[model samples]
Target chain A: MKKIFKNQIALALAGILAGTSAVAGTLVINGDTSDPAPKAAFQAVIDGFEAENPDVDVVYNLFDHEGYKAAIRNFLSADAPDIAFWYAGNRMAPFVEAGLFAPIDDVWADQGLYSLMASSAPGMTMDGKKWGIPYTYYNWGVYYRQDIFEDLGISVPTNWDEFIAAGETLKANGITPITIGTKYLWTAGGVFDYLNLRTNGYDFHMALTSGDIAWTDDRVRATMANYQQLIDGGFFLENHAALSWQEALAPMANGEAAMYVMGNFAVAPLKELGLDDSSLGLFQFPAITPGVPMAEEAPTDTIHLTAGAKNVADAKRFLAYAARPDVQTAWNKALGQLPTNAGAGVTDDKFLNQAFSMLNNDAPGGVAQFYDRDTKAEMASIGMEAFQEFMVKPERLEKILERLEKARQKLY
Target chain B: MYSYWKNNQLKIAPWIFLAPGIFMFSLYVIFPIFQSINLSFYQWDGLGAKTYIGAENYIELLDDEYFIVSLKNNVIWLVLYLLAVPAGLFAALFLNQTVRGIRIYKSIFFFPFVISQVVVGLVFSWFYDPSNGLLNIILEFFGFDTIAILAEEDYVTYGIIAAGLWPQTAYCMILYLTGLNSVDPEQIEAGRIDNARGWRMLWYVILPQLKPATFIAVVVTIIGALRSFDLIDIMTGGGPWGSSRVLAYYMYEKAFSEYGFRMGYGAAIAVVLLLIMMVYIATILYRLYQDEKGS
Candidate 1:
């Protein structure tokens, strides 16, 4: 028995030594890329990074998309990995303020990302310092049924009057002009962002989201008036509060609805449901108020370095690699999204090309992240709830705005 | 050590057996209760340093309309949930007869309780779906304009409670079924000879004997109603404007959800829920103690 114990001790010592050696060059990453396309895209990025740094081993922990929103808060403080996936703009502010994420200005400087990713730099920065590297973003616009438009002899609307008239024509024909699901609440937020961005211009919209302007202000009311016009016209899908975003797609797919004010992510599922590029088309959310510079909604996705990262050196290397134009081009191509790198090449997809040109040339005002990403989390929750309520009960706009103002007073 | 143990074995033996259980209970349950109560007094975002905020969280709860809405919904849940006790009793009485394939009938009635709550929630959500659901389809067939039951703020809570009742009624039915098996037949026969039948028979003879079963059923139902988080989460996510939020779901939303950052406020809500639960439990314990003495 003594001899067997001695042998076991010798084996245990060898195992411990081997573990330490493995830890020396391993880079741990935790991300919420559980979807198939994103999972494959991230895997390719890891493979490319590992190929460049032959001696390093990358350990990636992929979390479920929804669960990761809550899991990130736990792991960032409890068992911080070298790198983690997150969003850009105000969504990352809480973590940055708490010091859970480390500043990576050095990574950006070394990567020459200041000019390469200028469009996304403002989103990735906090307090005059860059916090993370934004890799990909997708545009939000009106995705309509091209066949339906042709049947009605309706052209794409470029202004608020034409947009309302298009909806009126669709409504006259017994079709819901817009199919939006407010069950999750964030979908209503996208509609609100477009309305506010168009009605009050980008600067005022930014100020309102940042709580520099009261929610009950006249500028906000102008945005609400535009939204109320759509709601009163019965433009949205019936019983939308009962459906999820995916469920709302059914009406559009079956021709019960003609248009959907949504993000590019909707294109994939819509195509799978048999609406190909010929049947589906994209248009900007139209200019609401004349001379209100046309900004666009493009929520950016980013990767961050945690403060408790064990392998800072190797993690920095991965951040720099992720920010590269070549790396972003391949990553976004696989993701079916737009790369943040100005020099990166886009995929040869119709919707992607249309969105790329729209954001690059048409948007002279600015690019605003969707409403939830542009505001405080608590405020975003309350604001989105109010928006959903307004969509369902347009008569309750006054009460909704008052409630939002109260929440803003307390939140910010 | 052996001599002392032998000399005081009767005094110390029970403690030795209880040590492990006591340690686990305190670690998992008792300690966390106190920790949560302590946490309610501080402002912590689940990440940065905690700041002592005294009674501010509780004070804010007093003015929060959402808190009041949650408390009101919880009250509604508690009252409506008790209906399951009688519903289960009637079901049990109906199924207790010995007939052709009686066991199959019992199993069919008990099926809801056997399945998971998540499945129950999903099935009911699909059943109440606005556009193509069976409920709307039937309503439309009857020439009644279709109503989105889960989406309307007025009907949302009642709809979820109806779904919760499916499994809860099954659970109570099972409890009463076993109680009915061991029921004293002599007293029931005597009561029948007294010409007591139907409601009178159930009220006097049957119900008196089913007290033990009724007691357990009521306790479990009240506890289940107070801790109703899963159904609310799965079905509506306390949504359609958060009109169906109960205290439990509200507490979770404030502390742990994707947008929640007010850890201290969530703990305060939890403490209020605990106090409400404690009032019921303490009264039940008092009644139990009184019965013990009476018997």
Candidate 2:
């Protein structure tokens, strides 16, 4: 009888110890880095983190990239992970407003991230407080075929008139001046954002996207008129509405299309398609209104700590680690994107070098997140559809703008 | 208790047999219908607290242009999808003859119905692809301008409906093929003796006996047309600016898509679809009752 009692006591003690360890030492992270490169890159970060903090046991859950969007809503309020992957700006606003994300202002102050990660600070901040740590961002600009440009003897255009002239020259040579696919619709959103940013400037563009300005305003029409110029010129590839963004790349690769308005992520795929550095070139989307300060589009990806996190201390530690310059440098190197940390060095690739310098030195106004990321989700969906419609049928711009105005009033 | 059961065994036996099915039907179907109707009166984002808005969602649906477009597309789908029934019947008649290796032809005809709807959607998407699809190639060969079928707002609905008919026709064909097996040969012989020719014989003799098959085919086709979502989702995602949307696809977009979680609005759409479906459902029930009473 005494030995049985002793055994029960021993089991109880072990259970108590295990429960305490699980509460204090285990950190859970959920992310959607399911692609091979990003999967491996994140796994390496987890390895390094575990090695540095041997006392903590890290558990990571990887979700399918497309499915993760729906899954985040369920897990955030029901069973939150310590760290969750997300995007910056208005994309994260719904979650932040619902108080599902925990604020980490102390972590930012302790790590001096306000200075170290100054470039992306505005994107990560909501209501005067930082809600997440932005690790990587990529620039959006015009990617062109250098050989085609040389063959036509057209120098890089720097203003609206020169841009139109160059496109006309390319079209006269039996080549499409630009190729874009709006089947998925966001490609057109990128074009609309850049046009609005250049035509009315960044502040006005922000106001319009934020639902503060009526889409029927003349400023929005000015942007649409500039877009109509390209459509009327027939500079875009034919039958683009039927193709995907990836499918559109084939025309550019085959020299049928000369330029693409795209993000830095297009470089790797272009290289794989046999376009070397000498054959492929990157340039900023040229000036439209001439005096609108040059703002670039650079969408930032971030990580957050959830409000329901149990291990807040370790989660904060992970956030701090993710914010470090060296860690971000290595992470962005693997991602083939630019580091959000101002102190971090970029990979020595041609596109990354050019993008890094362009974003830091040349862009003076500010970096805005791409259209879908900057605007409310419902607004983005409606706006992207309008953009796609305008690209296909520019004559219906009035009706489209009125539709957007109605949606904006209803949604906001 | 034994004496009570013995006194009312007939009534008790039927109740015992019906218990599980009744419980399940209420749980899965009947309750959800009521819940969706209730949800239509509220404003909820799926995660937040629901606010009672007193039929405001239905009010919005009246003004929503996308809703109108989806309704129009659904009507087009209903009218076009019924073409599958007659096509299937003719196909069945053509395959009814007993030649050598006739089973092979029947199997080939039934092939589409066996494969998944997703695969059907994909194959048709590739076939309709503008630059590289066989369709454009044929158009170009005929010295005609190639049309992007899915990208054109006017033709996108018809394009998706055509894809849907591929499998739907095969399904109806299989149904009629089975119904053909039980057809009375004696009646065909009598019709032949009476000097009935091909069209006359089929209309007066064969069709009356195939009434059960025709009834089933029409009901299933109507149901399938109302729920035509997968093809629209896979082919165009109701895209090129939501021109190809139907009620079912629009309901999904409103409730589940990344840019939407307007639960109340989605429920409103669901209620509208249910009301339309209820019309046909009521007719079906009435027909079934009349048939049952005649027997």
Candidate 3:
């Protein structure tokens, strides 16, 4: 018995050494970050990975926002990267169904990643498998110019009536009540998602996208009516249809616009424009109607390994290394984003800290935002068009809903 | 034996010389056109297996409101884009003087065509900006309210076309400048002896010699107008309610943009765009064929 035990111990030690040496291959990573801060975060993580595994060589290919999406689609169909950053939800569904993305269920189990990631974010896992792990998440809300609000003697409204009153107050003070750029259309969807969630709650919002509820339902129509009210009340920037999200920021920064309902990503640009912490503030999109269940906007960013990866083991190791608390801390700090890992350190930026708190508290019940990742691409395109139409011509509400229903039916 | 080499060998050698270019044109251009037409009948999301949908994509397109909007905007772009040709001729005439700085003025006039369309879109976007844009600032100085040209539905298409015209007019100016250089000096002397001068000299004498340049200009302008995408994409992305979507932009939105990878639907839209373009292209080709026969 003693002789057998010694032989087993020797085999186990050899296996550990072999495993360590095996992780020494080159890893190819594709990421999207035109922003300098995010690029710095990704670079730090790559450096740390190379340092820990001295024998391993990492090749990182970075692309801008739209280019990244196109490159990933083309790469998956041909020579896929060992690992990539991709949106969760239906955006990843096409690649997943094509058998291009490797399942990371075992990694999740081994690393106890489920406990670290927000429980609600497991929605990213599909078909009884976890395919990717999230690194950072951001909350969507009304990012207002606090100085402008204070100058106008207005406070953040908590409910529907107060929200309208606030808009009225801003308009009366010669400021555009809110600023938004719908040239890409998705920015408008962010506002619509919050309105729908605050009006009909998370479950109903999911049902609406899944086609469980009719688009012409009373609750959906009510949300549309609320949006129309905002548009008609001069709550949005003039000529919003012509501007991009970046262009819209100029008006807000110049104090011509009082508020901007946007995502955490907008913070970087605001800060770049010299808006101090005291000048900027955030508040959850107010509930318009009573008795509606409310949830905060917590959009997530995930890293996935391709099923077609030539270096599967290396990719898995990279993903696991990325999820480590130390790596997450370094990445999130440089990126100015909140880490998905529970033990990750916090940033001193007040807006980022507030975003983290909002997401931590409200993510458990929140639905993913509309467009890009939540609804089917076909559905989202039509939905964004409909939303833009509704904003421009409030009288077209019925026709828009009916058209969306037709699109939804075709999708299923 | 020498006659055989001269006749048969030379004939075959010309074909051999032409083979590579013909093959490439057929493969890259002709084959893809046919393939896009075929792909239009099947529903594919690029990755998943395609479904044979017959005329379903076309039927769906008919009901699509955005498609209707895009079609209307395309017509508007086509009509408005033609104005660039005459505008370019006028500019070229104005700058054709033999003054000390004429060459510099000619180079300055040709500058817009050299820059990328993306840069043109960005520069124009800044110029039209409502808060601090050049246009708005000028309007403010003149005691008029700032106009958001890109945002208003009625003006957005015109705004984009105006940007397009800037580069297009430059292209036409270069064509005319080259044509003006090649005009027969003897013919101009004859017209001058006949008392033709200034506008009459241009109309009766110089304009007749400039037909080839005008033909090339119209052909290019028509193709450019039909294929307008970059300006719309960079300027508004077919927005304010998709009021500015030309067929090309709409086709792109359907194919690759957040619109589902409805490859079939995108192909269908492309087919429609192609058919509309074919009308103008066929006319140009037919005109060229006649010209060849005449020669």
Q: Residue-wise lDDT of candidate 3 within B1-295, one digit each (tens)?
A: 8889777996789889999999999999999999999999999987779989899999988888789989999999889999989999998888877999889999999999999998999899899987779999999999999898987888999999999999999999999988888999999999999998999999989999999999999989989999998898778778777788988888777776645467788899999999998998899989999999999
Fraction of native Cα-Cα interface contacts (under 8 Å, chains A and B) also present in model 1 = 0.76
> Better model by lDDT, 2 or 3?
2
- Model 1: runs farther than 4 Å from truth? A1-22, B1-8
Candidate 2 lDDT over residue span A171-275, tens digit each: 899999999988888889889888888898989989998999999998888999999999999988887788888888899998999999999877888888879
> What value does DockQ give for candidate 2?
0.40
| TM-score for each model | 0.96, 0.96, 0.92
Per-residue accuracy of model 3 over A244-347 as CA lDDT, tens digit each = 78889988998888789898888878988878889989987887667766676666788999876777887888899988877888888887777888988878
Instruction: For candidate 2, report its TM-score.
Output: 0.96
Clashing pairs in 1: none
- TM-score (2 decimals) of chain A in model 2: 0.94
Stretches of candidate 2 exceeding 4 Å from the true structure: A1-23
User: Predicted candidate 3: interface RMSD?
Assistant: 12.2
Question: Per-residue lDDT of B20-49 in model 1, one digit per residue for the tens?
Answer: 999999999999899999999999888899
How do these models rank on lDDT, best leading? Answer: 1, 2, 3
Which runs in model 3 stand beyond 4 Å of their true positions?
A: A1-24, A362-364, A367-370, B1-7, B192-201, B258-260
- Chain B TM-score against the true chain B, candidate 2: 0.98
lDDT of each: 0.90, 0.88, 0.81
